[model samples]
Target chain A: MLLGKVKGKIISTRKHEKLVGYKLLIVEPYYGHKKDTFIAADKLGAGIGELVLVARDYAVKSGLDKDAPIDALVVGIVDREPEKK
Target chain B: MLLGKVKGKIISTRKHEKLVGYKLLIVEPYYGHKKDTFIAADKLGAGIGELVLVARDYAVKSGLDKDAPIDALVVGIVDREPEKK
Candidate 1:
């Protein structure tokens, strides 16, 4: 899992078929890492700027559709901010 | 799929049983991205410093064991360097 913040969300009306009812969230890892922003499937209602844990592998689609093109998923919402190094 | 270059190899004798016969390579994406080095299973015999296309999602384990703990796989080797903008 990767620690990241939900930067924003993408509202798509015509995405892949398998991703119909899911919210696509844009997330980026916190400080001390590259600012690579990626889109993940949000199920736990992660909101903008909220700290979240993203699973960016097969585990994301394990319970859903094994072949879903969705590569990332928000697994948790962290309650506290990360301590600055 | 993401484009990356093989930086080095991990020689481990006591890794997960599912990753026994595979070569674990350290790969980093090319310029214009965060230098996040990650390990991926190499089945194509990619060499160090070679540009490769890594599948960092479920597609990687589609053909093999879907439950395999391997998260990334070198899907293809690029023939030339990426064009800089």
Candidate 2:
């Protein structure tokens, strides 16, 4: 799982068929000091600038089709921002 | 996929049974300017400092046991350094 802030949303015209209904959010890491941002699938309605938990790997696919081409997903919107390490 | 140079090997005394024979290499992303390094399973005999390709998510598991706890994998070693974008 990754602690992140939903930075923004992405609009793609051509995407996988399985990704039709999901919103794509740009997530920035809150803990790892990583410079890159991840574009992840969102089904729980996470809004921009919100703190959330992102699940990676196949574990993220259980909520969608098995072959959705999604490597990251917005799993939770934090009730409160957790202390950063 | 990720383009990276193998940083080093990880020696773990206790790991998942499915990961027993696979070498774990530290892969630093060569693109996306990501600061985080990934611990990825390597079955292609990639050596330290070698440029390689890493496949992430469930797509990485096709070469191993599906239930393996591996999310990153060294899929191919580059023949030469490709042009970086």
Candidate 3:
């Protein structure tokens, strides 16, 4: 799993059938030093600027379901602030 | 590659050396239906709520160079809005 922050949303008009109705959000992964940002899907009610945990690839597909066809998935939303100590 | 939005940050007191300076972001992939959010590393200067593209697994390692032990990495940030029509 990885850590990131919700940046924004993405709207797609043309896409695959497997990916309909899903909310797209831009995310920045929080490593120790700096923040790395990217795009991902939100299954939970995660809003922009919320700290969230994510799973990817096989982990993502498996987390959602075997037949979910998802490459990424938001597993959890961070409730408390991350400790830098 | 996949799509996601920046959600939040992750701070770990102890981590791998390769991941020391790398930024980790919470991301949700845009899978057409519902967003499948995940955590990924960002190499670009993407802010919160920015639509970005991600490369996972081998793609990530290769994109950032083999020496890097990154499982996920942001390759591109979406400049325009994704069409939902």
Candidate 4:
């Protein structure tokens, strides 16, 4: 998983059947001073600018059910700073 | 999948066993007027600011092998504009 900040939401008039009820957010992956922005499927009602944890690969499948059609998903919202380096 | 420009590469001193040889690129997902930036795994040697296609979920497994430890992987680089609306 990677740390990211939700930047904004994406609105699509048409989408895949499996993505109908999920929210799409543009997330900027934050690694210390580095930020790599990307979009992801959000089902946790994460707000803009909220620090979030993004799950990938097997983690994603485990976080959201194994059958979920999600490659990248917002798994958690960070409420406080983790141990600093 | 999403189109993006390869902004830069990420160098990690520590990584999972499967990700050791794969290149990681900070990508910005592009949607015409809307540009959603994010990072992704790039296996195609894509350059910075190059448009590319991202594969998610089952697509990722099909693009790569089934056991590849990638949920979001750069599958292809776009050389021309797709059909506009």
Best by DockQ: 2
Tens digit of lDDT per residue, candidate 3, span A1-85? 8888776776654333344556777666766322234456677979988988988776665565324334557889998868867
Ranking by lDDT: 2, 1, 4, 3
Estimate the TM-score for candidate 4: 0.51
lDDT of 2 by residue, B1-85 (tens): 4457788989998877878888989888754544678798887788898876565878565545456788887655665654432
Fnat, one value per model: 0.11, 0.12, 0.08, 0.03
Query: Which docking class does model 3 fall in?
Result: incorrect
Model 2 clash pairs?
Answer: none
Tens digits of per-residue lDDT, candidate 3, B1-85, equal 4666777768877988778777888876553323456678776766788766666774353355336677667766666755432
Predictions' DockQ, in order = 0.08, 0.09, 0.07, 0.08
DockQ result, candidate 4: 0.08
- Which prediction has more favorable DockQ, 2 or 3? 2
For model 2, how does the per-residue alpha-carbon lDDT over A1-85 read when each residue is reduced to its tens digit? 8888876665544333445687776677888644555567788999878998988877876756555546678888999987755
Q: Give lDDT tens digits, candidate 1, residues A1-85.
A: 8888876665544333455577766566776343365556777999887999887776776645445545677788999987977
Model 1 chain B: weakest 10-residue lDDT segment is: B76-85
Report lDDT per candidate: 0.68, 0.70, 0.65, 0.65
Worst 10 residues of 2 chain B by lDDT: B76-85
lDDT, model 4: 0.65
Structural similarity to truth (TM-score) of each candidate = 0.50, 0.53, 0.50, 0.51
Candidate 2 displacement at residue A54 in angstroms: 0.8
